[model samples]
Each structure stands twice: as C-alpha cells, then as structure tokens.
Target: MKKNLKPTITASFLAIAISAIACQNNSGKTAQTDSLKQDTSKFLTQPLISNIYTADPSAHVFEGKIYIYPSHDIEAGTPENDNGDHFDMRDYRILSMDSVNGKVTDHGVALDIKDIPWAGRQLWAPDAAYKNGTYYLYFPVKDKNDVFRIGVATSKTPAGPFKAEPQPIKGSFSIDPAVFTDDDGTSYMYFGGIWGGQLQRWKDGKYDANGSKTDSQKEDEPALTAKIAKLSNDMLSFAEPVKDVIILDKEGKPLLTKDHDRRFFEGAWMHKYNGKYYFTYSTGDTHFLASAVSDNPYGPFTYQGTFMEPVQGWTTHHSIIEVKGKWYIFYHDTQLSGKTHLRNVKVTELTHNADGTIGLIKPLKK
Candidate 1:
C-alpha cells in the first residue's frame, strides 16, 4: 500500500518464510486429476536467502528454530517517501535462524530495537506462538499514533527481553499481524493490513482488549481475503468469526472483478494439512505472493493458487515455510536490468489437491 521502489542495498544475506484449506479447483490448478496430483516440485527455492533485509518475513518453528519475524527495512537512505518515507519506524527488529536441523548454519538477532517496549519508530508485521514455555510476539505499531496498535510481546527466550503484553489486542483496527496455533492447541489472531476491511480480533484468549466482541462489514471485504483467525485457549483473542469461524470465503467473493487496487490479501499466513486450513496470501500491485483457501481456521474461504507472480518486475511481500513435509513460498523480487524498485528475495514450491487446492510455481528465469 506504500509505493516507491529502487532497492539493491548491498547484502546482509539470509532469508526464507503459511497455510489453510478450502474447496477451490478454480482451474488455476490446471487440472491433472489424479486426485489433483501435486509433488510441488520439492518446494522450490529462491525465496530470498537475503536478497537484502528481506521485508515481510514471519515464519515459526519454536525450539526447532526457523523464527523470522520481519519488518526492518532500516530506512536505508531515508527518501522514496512511499508514505513510509524511507521506512524509519526505528527499523523494528527481530530476526533469527536455525532452519530445523540442517541448513541455516545458525543466524542471529532474536529480538531487536534493544529488546522492545514502546520500542519507538515502527516495527510492523510479526507473529509467533509457543505457549506455556512462552514466545508469543505479534506486532505492528507506529510506536504511538494515538496507538496504531497491534502488539503483544513476551518471551521465555526465542531471542530475549521481549515482554510487552500489558496491553493492545482487543477487537479493532489492525495491521499485518498473524498468529496461528492449531492442530488442537487452538489459538488464532489475524489482523487487517487494510485498504478497507478484513478485521477480526475477538481475542478469546484473554488480555481482554476491553472485553472483545467484533464483527465487521462494509460490503468490500475482499482485497483477496486472508486473515486466518481461530484462537480461543487464551492466545490473546479470536475464537470465532472468520465471518463465523473458518469455512472458506463464506461467500465473500471478489478477488477483484475490477482493480479496486489489485485485490491483495495484504500478507496473511496459516498452514494446516490433513485437517484443512491453508489461507496464504499476497497479491500483486507491487506484490507477488498470492494464495487463497479455507476449510475453516475461521473462514468460508476458497480461491486456491498463485503462490508467486511477476516473472521479473513485480514480485511482492510473502512468508511461508514448511520443512519436513515440504511446502515453501517465501517472496520478494526485481533485480535484473536492476531498478524497477530494487526489490530482492525469492522462493518457490507449493502444491496441493486431493481436495486440498493450491498449486503455485512461476518465476525462475531472470
């Protein structure tokens, strides 16, 4: 939603980064039929191993380690004024790496902005869930814009000194926040990246947010739809109403019948298989990450496919990594003739169908 591109900042190296399920065979799957046949080409690779400070990364693995909660463009030279005007929200840091058991070599920065708390500037889009042993980050802030709120920090050490959950997380105006903990642990919180409505934060996990209870609507609820809310065991909020708690697009159609500005799902994430709920997002405009699905995570969703778009000059914000069972879709692009916006980072591989629905793979030449 903020435009002004021309990035190529040297290199700090390292990066990679969803889920949900619905019943969409919209033909984007291209139809193979053998139960939809999908090996996902072993979850391709290129999703930025640091094409530069990565951008909107948010992956998790807890003690298994793959934690990437991004939104620290550092402000670099400080001009370009894409509304973010060089993005100086104090760079809001929190980066780490372990890559399961084999390939991250081991990276650093477990929680930055000197550990956090009102941690000035702005530290957008973050999400992690560990429970009991403690980790829960969940971010988004102008530091103070009368409180553009979307915070909830704590840590028993997924990095260090997190602690900031004394407030923020009650049914209301949000940001690119995502937190999922399903498979039965039941926890959910998906926020609005806003262009106009995608809201939900009934925080059933307590922290109360002034006694949660929200249900929004203004007609245009489809910027491609993907907020994935469901939590209710006290992860802070939302135990219902993805429009009534996970079922897939619930009839909230319109991935863009006409560019009400590229119909983007902003940058939401979630992944749950065998039990269905793969609501991944990020649609072009300046974006590349794209996905849609819903079988319940707090949804009525449906529109499976397009995990990466723009072959060379339009890629977008994204995050998703699922090692061990395989499925990858981390994004960022533009670096050839150099300077369409200087963006970098790229990854691939994501396939499905057997009633699962998702099959993205395009962009490998430049």
Candidate 2:
C-alpha cells in the first residue's frame, strides 16, 4: 500500500499550498480596494470661499474640524506706485468647516499686520497647528527693516482673534513657516523660499544648518531647495538645527534648477502618511503645486512631479491634510479677482496611490 504513496502525498500538499496562496491574494486585493476607496459625497467644492481673495492656504485639524488660516490679499498697488510686484497682503483670516461636506464659515480676520510689532505690512504665507489644546499660528511678513521674518500668533480656540507675539522668531529670515508634530510628541518646523534658501528649525529655537540657505553662484540662481527642523516642546521656537532637504527626481537624482518646471519656489507644506514624509510646494514663475517624498521627515526627498497645475495663470500655493479618512489639498487661485496676486482659497479632494504617492490634481472650474 505504501509503495508509491510519497509522490501522492507531496502532490496533495502542493495543491493545498497553491489554493491558500490564491485565497490570500484575493483577500489582499479586497482589503486594498476598501482602504483606497473613498466617497465623493462628503467632499466640499473648490473655491472654499467666494467673496474674498485668500492665498497661501495652511490647514490644520483641531477638535474634529478643519481650520484654514490664509493670507487675505487686497488690491492696493497701482501702476504708479507698484514696483511691478503687486501681491499686497496685510492680514489673515480663519475659515473652518464642521463636517466633511459642511459649509465653510469665515471666522473673519484672526490677526492683523498692525498688531505684529516686528512685522511690516506685507503678511505673506501663514500656517497653523494645535498643541495641548492651544492653537499657534505662524506667519511670514516683511520686517520693519524690510527683511522677511516668521512670526507667531496664539489663540485659545481654533477660530481666533489671535494675538501676535511682539518679536519675530529670531534668526528666521524667510517666508512660509510650516509646523509639523510627530507621533512621539515632538514638533518640527520647515520653511524658506527663493535665492537658494530652504531651512528647518526645532521647536526649541535651534536651526538645522545641514539644510540651511546656501549662497548662489550662477547668474540665474537655482534656489528651489526646501528644508526642515525639529520643534521644541512649547512649539514656539526651534529645537534643532535646520536641514536643507533635497528633492530628487524619480531616478533618485536631484532635480537641480531654478525654473518652475523643475524646482520648488515658495509655499512649503509638510504632511506625513504611513510613516512617509511628503513635502509639497509651489513652483516659482509657473504656479504649479508640486511635491516630493522621503522616508524621514527631514529628507533628501525624491521629487514625485507636479500634482496640480496653475489656476488660470495665477501662482498656486497649497497644503495637504487628511480629515475623517478623506484626503484634501487646500490651494488658491485668482478666480474671484482675475488678477495674478489676488487669489481665492480653494479645496478639493486628493487621492494617493497604493504606494503612498499622490495623484495629479486637476483644478475644478466650479
């Protein structure tokens, strides 16, 4: 009876193994489908606000709601007075939505340029974060000496009449301040812009020089670099040295250039998903919203390519966030004003690939 039984037994085992593998594969596909899937019914429409020109949208989730702290742009420059650069912004407004498909409410002006002692009139890009139940707003403005500096404002609630701190964060001389808090309760700040500058600093007020501002050598300086740093426990200052994180192409090489088609301009936004760091930015001159990714927060990130193109030829700036399991990108356009500098805040649902890469976002006209 046992003369030829070994071969039969082996074949039976192999058949069972193959069936189990097939079952497992089918299960995995189902799970992935459920995870990557989303319902569009819950998403709010683009151009979150209509009456005002809002730019540089920085979004944060606090107490189950998404709050947007954006720069309020106004038409102040005339041909006789402007130096050809007409982005005349002066204050910030806080807008919030209660539910996934809820209406956006303008909480009105949260902070003003006149309230900040160290800042000048041009209040540029801003960001907000929540910590230990307190909300902190970081803003970039020209200093009294005409130098750009990042300043902080604080509020007890998400929608505030936020009070500005008297002085700028010392040693922070650039635009766009993005704050990120990690899982371990540690916080970090990433910032910077044109002329070969991109920097990071810790919450304790220490700058990360590994990715700090580098001096330009060429006549057309390539300054599309972005940077990151850890933040102190209080979240009011830098806690570590800044690192100039490099954005590389898909081939794992740096996309070295100053042109918008290949480089990062201003509007630095940081987001973490599935333990990966996504650094999203606005491309200079071209006005496209581009992105890069890295395993570590302070990275030498690999450029993933442009996710969103220009909105009617206006410069685009944005932030990405996930609320209630749905992803969204908050950006700005000139639909309301029809002018380059006067932009209005917009929001649309964002999608990611199974590999954690973001998909290209086409601006919605509606």
Candidate 3:
C-alpha cells in the first residue's frame, strides 16, 4: 500500500549544492577545498527520499525486498546542544525498495509517539527483525522520566503499523538498539551510546541524573563499551544480564577514553561475514564509521580501522546488509536540508577485503 508521495528533487538538488559550499567553508581543509573546487556534484550521495527528512537508517531485507526503518527527522525548534535536544523526532515512516536503485516506497507513518503508552518524545534510531510470523520494531526513545529506554513494537507485516507494548523493555536503557539474529535462531541486541545517548549515566547500573557527557573522565581507563544481551524467546525483553561488548586494540588492551578515533561512541550494528562477527559503530564526535572483529557474537573484539569518512552531518549512524550477493551500507547526511537535525538517508555499496577487513567508504565521491 504505497502512497502517492511527490518527489522534491528540484529543491533538494539546490540544497545539496549549497550544503557542499557550507561544508567546505566550515571545514577549511585543503583536501575538502580541492575536492569542492573540482566537482561540487560529488559532495553528496543522492538521498533515498527527499519529500521528508530521515536519519539513522536501519536497513534489512525482508521477503526479497529491502525495508528500511529510520528515524523520522523533523524541524523541531528545540535548540541544538551537546545533549541532542534539537533532534525531536516523534514518529517513523518505513521505506521500501524492490531492488538496488529502484523505485522507493514511503509507507507513510508506520508508528507514532502518541500510540506508545510509555514513550515521552524524541523517537530515535530503530531496528527491525522478523520471526515466527511477526515483525518486531526495536526503537529507543525517552520515557516519562526523561531517560532513554528501548521499546519493541509488533506487526504482522514488515512494513508495519506496529503496535508498541504498554511499557518499555525492562532492563533496557540508552539508545540505538541493533538486534542481530544468529544462525542458531538466537537474537542478541547490541545497544548503548554516550553523550546525549545517556550510556555514561548508567555506569553504576543506576541512572544518575547528574553524569558527565563523556566516558571515563580518565583517558587511561577503559572506554565505556556498548552493551549486549540475549533477547528472550518471545523477543519482548532480555533473557540474561546485559554485558559490555569490550573492544581492544591489536595489543589486546582496552581502548582508552582519549582514543576518540577508535573508541565506541554510539550506533552499534552487528553482521556476520565469512564465519566471523563484525561489530561496527560510529565514533561520534570524531565522525567515523569504525569496526572490530570477534570470533563470537558476544565479543571482546579487536579494533579495526575506520571504514567510513565523515559526511555533512554531525551524527553518523548506519546499517550494513547483504542483498543477493552484494553488500551495501545505509546511512544519512545533512545534504537535503544543510541542517544537522534535518537529514536524508542514503545507501552505497560496501566491500570486504580478502583479508576480512572492510574497505574504507567515502560517502561523497572524490
């Protein structure tokens, strides 16, 4: 049931060009300046949908089609801050495509904040899974107490008019819930984010209203890691205690807090490739998409290097999925609006090297 949504390509193209200029001026880097001087058109990847702003795309293949569940970005007047008050998104619209670079369908508003009984506002990044004839939409949002908690919604179809549970998922906190189902039918959720994501606030297993935005003020101490837990058989809650997904350097030592280029900031996504598990996430303030590899689903992963360069936005969230025999990474940038809060989702092909390391991705073509 696709709706007749008109394309806003003309206006979006103009904005994209303007955003390239703005990024060059703001960055003042010689490489960026040189690239901008050559071909401004290469500065942006075409957005999947231009009619409405979207971000934090969690893409999946369901029933031989590509379905994307992303945060529905809006121009909420809340001021931008380190705490992320301006990303006041309230709902989600599911996007679908028949194949790569094919006609995309905006299935309209699949879920809204008002329908979720426990949610307060700011419906952020989400992920989806299909099992036992039901589709589960996993999302992170602020609760009545202003704490970010993860919740699940269910629907009969992949493109959902999902019905959320009356309460938040017990023992789930922080943001960005990425549910990865293993080959044995076991599903594990990898989640957590620092800064405005509130992962640092729960260091003592209790929420602290007063907590630092950064992780481990001491740089030598271990960086705060992402959390993982096995989902219950019904997929409503955690089956076991949440455990930290430890990331280590090649020397097998924990990454220090000051290692911004490698430390985990947020946006945890897991995918299995060639019998190895790949855990990837964004290095928030540093603006890089980095990865680590482990032999097990619950990992003490060793650090790999950056796979993606910065886009035109402050936040970088993504999902990697295999389509047919090819893999693609879905992400978002501010090209459509030239404002951080108003973003547009885009996708590009990804490659894994013969040595199992991921090839670096440049969101904007050089």
lDDT of 2 by residue, 214-300 (tens): 323242653446667677777777777666768877886666564558687678888888888888888766777888888888787
* TM-score of each prediction: 0.29, 0.78, 0.90
Worst 10 residues of 1 by lDDT: 26-35
Alpha carbon lDDT at 51, candidate 1: 21
User: Which pairs of residues have clashing backbones in candidate 3?
Assistant: none
How many backbone overlaps does candidate 1 show? Answer: 52
- Report lDDT (CA) for all predictions: 0.49, 0.67, 0.85
Query: Between candidates 1 and 2, which one is better according to lDDT?
Result: 2
Candidates 2 and 3 compared: the better one by TM-score is 3
TM-score of 2: 0.78
Candidate 1 C-alpha lDDT tens digits along 218-336:
33453334444565565666556544222233255465423323344356777787777766665534455545566666665565655565545443566677866887655554431
Clashes of each: 52, 28, 0
Q: Over the stretch 44-115, how does candidate 3's per-residue lDDT look in tens digits?
A: 457766656779999999999999999988766789998898989888888888887676777777888999
